[model samples]
Target chain A: MSELVDCRGLSCPEPVMLARQALQETGNGTVQVVVSNAVALDNVTRAANQMGWQVSVEEEGEEFKLSIKK
Target chain B: MRDRLSIIFAGAVVGLLAVILVLQGNPANMGFCVACFIRDIAGGLGLHRAGVVQFLRPEIIGLVLGAFVTALYVREFKSTGGSSPLMRFLLGMLMMTGALIFLGCPLRMILRLAGGDWNALVALPGYVLGVWFGTLFLKKGFTLGRSQVQTAVNGYAGPFIAAVLLILLVTAPAFIFFSEEGPGSMAAPLFLTLGAGLLVGILAQRTRLCTMGAIRDLILFKDYHLFLGFAAIFVVALVGNLFTGQFIPGFEDQPVAHVSSLWNFLGMTVVGFAAVLAGGCPMRQLILTGEGQSDALLTVFGMGTGAAFMHNFGLAGSPAGVSPAGQWIAIISLALLFIIGISNVNLHRKAKTKDYSKAS
Candidate 1:
């Protein structure tokens, strides 16, 4: 099953780091990350892109949904 | 090591400071104010000759020795430097100048408000606003560049200076400045003050306590390690102050403070910006200096030299109010910060372009 990681209220490099760490630990899985700020969302997207993971972002008001697959 | 342990350490340090302040007759929020006390020390050493505020504070000595001892114990003491040290020194100067104009460091400003000094309330928002702008610059890719590892002697320079200052404080040398009256004179006893400073330094070192870093971390990376420490300090200090009967509520005529709301806010705005730019609060900078961060050391010297210039040029504010010269310095400093941001952004853009070209 795909895992969801809600990183809302988390700041830069954190959501990114958390997502990466989770993906590594989970070892090839789908993950969804929620970020409260544009910067964090952008950072997560960048990290996902860099890691060659499939990513889709959903905007829900002030929050963002970043889904990634490895 | 658990992160919770760091918070406990910070709480203990705040507790120790409360005890010290209670013993010394300082108001509850009066513990561990590097900027305020240094101003007093400046007057005590006859630097500004501000009457009624002269006192040779033991806290500064304590902070240096405490951090130095802890760093030694942890084997983290590595002296290195040779970065743009002089520039750091100048920034430190601007930092102190701005802080004095505001009448407190970020920690003290928060502490002051927690103790019910509404004057600090005015400064707090300005600080956050300044940090916000700094964050924008950071988002735009502004950086101070990298600091290369230097010989151990470079780090020694700061401690050596601190040691000499301590000796001068004790000796009351003619060349060294002192204030005859003002907030400088109203100081806690020597040993107790130093003890409080040492405890703060040790805890701060262990926990990486920094008020500015706390705000910045929350703003930048949502890292709570530093902010938690800040919260602990405030909570502990608030309780300590209340128990000690040092909690005086009101904005008008708080001890060692002024009431110019606009300048108060703007002053901290400058401090907040500089602190974020420099990567730590004044106390953090001092601890880093002790721990062999040459850049931090340079910032300390910058503060001291800034103090000298502030007093010499009549730029330091008083309970009376901010000087025109002080106002001008703040404006110029802000302008310079903007210029630095622009250059750093341009450089980052260039780097990104080159990297992209190579990758393609």
Candidate 2:
């Protein structure tokens, strides 16, 4: 299984940074980012898209899991 | 990138407006200060009895309206809130306490420095230090949590208030106070001030210009993108000051300024620290409010109330310097900021989650 990026409880740009790093490191396949808030979800989704990745989102409880792929 | 550089141009325009407003009749070195204007607005609304600084500033009204219009036009307006609203309100008050202690917001701080006010120099490091401290909290995973999307009416409230205030100013309602002396008595033409504010609001919203963000970005990522905007404001305003003969670099005899070094430093330190937790500066708060964020609206209310509280309790500083009470307020603000910053962070999450940065 691919490693998950747990960006939960992190502030604004931190979650975005971690998500971007995961995307860059994986270089292919899929990466999922779990964020505790919508702001982080938006930021990470935007960052991933900017890097030319496609993202699908799933809301689980109070957190969101963003699945990103090339 | 060309897009990032646009903020610099926007900052330059704002700087030019500051000088022009002064030439047109704003207080010396007081072009567009959010904290001062909000305080004056509070006094105008009779929230406080500060007679010398009482007027419904049209520039403030224009800022909200302009950003609201621009946000709507760009389809960027989204109504959202419910992330620690009460806490944000108090943090807003904390931010205002700092600004009042220093007699200016971050925007006004840059303008003060541009006007060759030596006092701003001392506040600069303090402000930087505050942002730095905020970065530490960020490193430890501090967050105010997520905000949920709200209905359209929620987003319209802030702009609606601004429009109402504009009408009140034009009609000269009896309920609102207008100052006969001191800074409140000084003002540019209503249309002119409002026009400048509108222009700034539109530009700022488009460029995402923020004083706190400028410092935060530099420290967090070593990215100087936002710093360009900060430098542009200072450079443009400084040159304008020189040509207009407003540049007088000294600690003494500066208009509406204090010579106290320790208070000035501590005051900005409070401002910077609280701003990070709150997610924006005073001007940014206004823009966010215009963009339909209820949390930002609460912060705005906090600032207005804080302004009233400062005057009512005799805690705001003047040219003479901060009172013992105001100094204590400053100290309390820092302590409160520390509590707020530390309490919100869930560092235990860090232990459960693996950092993605090591993936490389």
Candidate 3:
């Protein structure tokens, strides 16, 4: 099962940090990170990419959901 | 959709945060200002003998420390330096000089506007114009070169220094100065301020929220992503101020502000230009320094020194108006920034032409 990390109301580094944590703890599975801002979206994407994860993004209303898969 | 929501959310959160700080007694309409707080910090360190503005701000220290901790935990801490450190320092100093003349940085400018200070309305356009002008040079291929990766110790230095400063603030040593009165003497509770700083630092580092970058990107790339976030701050803050009975709109007699419209505009113009040249706003520079960018650390120090110079030499304006010396400094700084922009652009162009000639 994919793990979920919701960082919608949080700002930059928090979302990025949460996303990183989700990725790290989940090890090899899929991790879904939800964020609300462009900065968070961009940073989370960059962090996921750096860890060699394939990422897919979805727009949910005003929030973003990033699915990172190993 | 998500990007838009995130920007707005970030903006609203910051706005609300600023209002809360103000309500909690962090100076009227002067909540969460990086430049002003840094200036106060400079005074605290006895970098300047300015009695009225001396205080070790926990927010500044917390910002650096917060960013440092987050960067380390995420393994994004890469110590780097040697990217025109002196130039960055000069740009930072110039940036601070401009901000002090205007009595606030870009963040405070927006906060002031949110709190219904019309003077900020004037300064805003000047800031935008300055950033637009800087973008012209950027399009012409102006660059600050690249930074090389350094050792871990180098990366840790900024955060280490910040940590030490936090200790000094806590210890209240006799040598370190503290404001007995004035804006320097005013602040929210220490723990609250530190927490606010850490929270802002983390969020800013993650999202790369920068007021100057918001303007630069909007002008250059027609990108509204970052702009939307900052705009949200204004909107949210305005609403919060209205609700809290803090909204007072007019041109004159605003708290901690002057009615000198021309200087306010020109002063921020200098800031806008220097921030662009330095590749980030003051807040962004602090975040970068925390993330182990040595060049940015130098810029932060330059800002501190610039603040000291402003107060010590009476180049900083008050609610009364800009001093004659401050006016002269603003004019000179503007000229210096333009020179730096033009020369950098021309030098790059010349280098490109030389390379082409060699190829031919």
Candidate 4:
């Protein structure tokens, strides 16, 4: 099962930082991260990638869906 | 005491802005709004193409050159470097985006209401609330970081750019950009506009005048030194409008304004918070750029880019009301600001670790 962390509407590093913390808290297989901005999505993906997690980014309107798997 | 020279300096600045508006045939109610004028310039340069609002206002160009000349005279001109410049640039963009959405900067909101634009009434409170929150963050120690002195080349950079713009203003290049039929299209004569800009530029530089700083200082330190200048602008503008028969009372159909109170308030709230964080309003930023502060220049560029985005995305307000897109951006922007504020604050520290270290 994938846990979701919705960070839509948060600006800049916050979205990515929150996703990292959530991932760490879950300490597990898969996590879904969502953000309202393209910049934030890129940050999330970059942060996830650094942690050696597999990630996919999907766009919905102005928001992004990032599915990360460990 | 001559230290009180700020009052006379600010008064002179107000008087200079008045002359520019009167000479330009702008709604006498309006004068020297960096945000509004820049919006008009964007419209003029065909950036946005918003009709009835395109004009290559000479006052803006004058502001830069004016400060440029004064900086040269006072020997206060020194170029400098800023840390996190790109981030500051982006912050400026967001700042402008928020200001345009509300149809005024913090300075113009007061001007708008002082000129009897009731829509501005809504914005005043929001501005206060936003500044209050910013002050809270400041109390908790949020800062963008310090600027370092740089090579003389950096100080001359903005002056060089301003000189080029001045050249463009004078030469009227055959390929010069201008709006065909928008607020950008409306304009006052070159000399009159520039003269006004120069006068205010000198006066502002002398006094360290800033509308946003005026209010911020008052709230943060209970200081009135700067607020006096702001109060003077309102008093002078109100009187000038009354004398010129420019004071029209109404929420609807006000020049360069909209009627949505909630968005108006929210828009300026964003501007106020951003201005506080950024350290000055648009006009103050211009002055700083003239003095060779590259960070302020970045902020100005950010504001210009933000204006472009606001127009392109239909996120700017009209006389009728705020755009739905603008409202969405406002909501998202506020949340983003909150997150930035909270996370960057560095609140939780092992007792011995010290939060002041982050601050210092």
Candidate 5:
């Protein structure tokens, strides 16, 4: 199972950094990040991609779940 | 489509308001300038003795009240703060200094651009560079730390003060100053200004409209969400200016603006850097204050204090251009921002991050 990083209600840059931290901890495994808003989702996706991860976002109600895998 | 339309609507309304306010008696192409308006409020309260820019702008009061009402209606108002309040306050002061030197905030920058002030173009690159610097800090884990839920009273302070200011504005008390002439004396009808403020405040709070965030998000996330709002304001304002015969292209003799290229660039650069560090633009800070964020409130307080300090000390810029002291303050603001940014960067990468949702 992949690690789940809950970033609900967090703003931009913070969510991006959290996703980066989770990715580093996994180190080539899968990581899932959940954010509350569109801005955070876009930011997290870009950050994960910059770190060489494949990202796919699933809308979960008002929150967005980002699945990032290396 | 709905979301985009809402943002566009918000921006277009703001653009239209600026034009209307200008035509109604506000300064030319300066229907809304948060930094300058806050400075005027400072003067109104006798915080400074600037003769030409003192009136407790009704629009300012209306914005805070409107945001206050909207946040409560939407069930989004919460009292939260305590993440480096003092640092945020200082950043707010520096942010004001930068904006005052530029003679406007980011919102005004967009308005000026729409009015065809090319000097804002020079400031644009500087603002972007400053935001890029801020993004570098974020990449290195720069955060002011998480805030905690504070008492409800803390949340009410901003709006409470705003309401009180509204009273003072209406009463026209003896202690308050009103400019006999100059930009301060120039204002749209009081009720009309207040109504526009309320409407824009609600829309801005609803859409999370922020000019500083527009540039920052573009650089950090390649996200055009906020930039769409930014573009809408520019486009709408340009059209309005053209229709109103207010679009005076070129850098010279712009209304309430000067032609110092270097200071214009650096002033906005300082504003952008400090705003990123403070977590929002000047207008965003006010909106957050209404939503009950004490950290943002302190920043707002700092901005007012900075305005007073700038005017009293003659550190503020005027149409004569930035004084030597104003130039020095802008440069020193950059140094201070660099120090604040570097020192706050957490070098240690926590394997498990702390709660950042509580972050501003």
Candidate 6:
């Protein structure tokens, strides 16, 4: 099962940080990180990629849900 | 896609909030200003001895606390420091000095323009030029170096200090300064200001909304992602100002604003250059400090102390016009920033070339 990290209404490094934590907890599995802003979306995506995770992003209303798999 | 929409939404929300705060009795065309608020806070702490500009602004306190709480809740709090702390401190001081000379920061520069203050038109281009100048150094590999992770307590200091300030604000201690009747004396209700600050803090934290970064990114990487957010704020605020009847075209007799276009341009140029060198705007520094970046905390402290010095030494501009001292300081700051930028870039390049030759 994929773990979810919701970072709605949060800012910048927070979303990236949360996504990182979720990825660590899930190890090699998939982790879904949801963020509300473009900056956070970009940051989280970059962080996930840096950690050697495959990243795919989906738009959900005014928020982004990124699915990362190691 | 979703992220872009969110930036727009955040911009609209912030625009609306700024208008609401102005209508609710904050300073005209002054709803959310980091540098001005920090100056006021310095006065409140008796750092500057400025009688009229003294006030313990709750919004600033709430901003730090809000970011701190959110960072803690999300488990993203990391205490770190040791990345050119002294340089960061000096940059912060220079940044604040320039901001005071212009009577606003980057955010207020935009807000001033949205409210029809034509003075900002001059400052805006100067700001871009300054950022562009800084980007030249950035391309040359100018860096403050990497930060080292430290104990959690290091991250909590800014928040703890903010909490204490909130308490002081609430208690109204006799020693703590409060404005008698000036820009500082005029404020919205405490709860409303705090709410606005908290909201902005949360949104800014989420969106990484930085005016300097917006310009820097656009210049360096041709990225408009963050720039869109600022554009949204300008458009939305323009509409809001129109509705609030705050749109007074032309620059004459603008509240708390002067008419010297040359100084306006130079002042913000100082701000833009220093802010770019420091890696963020004043608001961004405050947010980072809340998130446990000790370097940012020092920067904020530097800003506060610089504000005090600006006021005490008559280096800050006034409604009449830019002070003589302020004008001199702006020139000196630009020259100093240029020296810092050039020297740092050369040192880094030499170091890199040395390492490359050794490896070969």
Give fnat of each prediction, in order. Answer: 0.00, 0.10, 0.02, 0.00, 0.10, 0.02
Q: lDDT tens digits, residues B1-360, model 4?
A: 353466556754674476356546654445767887777666656677456666666777777777878877876665665645876687687778778878877767767766888888888888888878777776564656445667888777776776776676677675556666545655666676777878777777666677776777678656566678877777777777677666778888888787788888889888888777777788888887877778878888788778888888888887767767789998887776676666556454111111221122
- Model 1, A1-70: lDDT tens digits are 3346655543333455567666666667777676655545655775666667988988775467777888
Q: Better model by TM-score, 1 or 2?
A: 2
Q: Score the docking of each candidate (DockQ).
A: 0.04, 0.19, 0.04, 0.01, 0.20, 0.05
Cα error of candidate 3 at position B76, Å:
1.7
Q: What are the per-model C-alpha RMSD values against the true structure?
A: 9.1, 4.7, 10.2, 14.9, 4.1, 8.2
Which lDDT tens digits does candidate 2 get at residues B173-238? 899999999999999998889999899999887877889988997887666666888899899999
For candidate 1, write residues B28-64 as lDDT tens digits: 4667677766666666566665565566667776777
Q: After superposition, how far is residue B84 of candidate 3 from its true place, in Å?
A: 0.4
Residues B88-135, candidate 5: write the lDDT tens digits.
999999999999999999999999999999998988898888888888
Candidate 2 lands at a TM-score of: 0.88
User: Which of the two, 3 or 5, has more DockQ?
Assistant: 5
What CAPRI class is candidate 1? incorrect
Q: How does each model score on TM-score?
A: 0.77, 0.88, 0.82, 0.77, 0.89, 0.83
| Ten-residue region with minimum lDDT total, candidate 3 chain B | B350-359
Model 4 has fnat of 0.00
Model 3, A1-70: lDDT tens digits are 3236766544333455456666777789777777655556886786677678999999865567778899
Residue-level lDDT for A12 in candidate 4 = 32
Question: TM-score of predicted model 6?
Answer: 0.83
Estimate how well candidate 3 is docked, as a DockQ score.
0.04
Docking class for candidate 2: incorrect
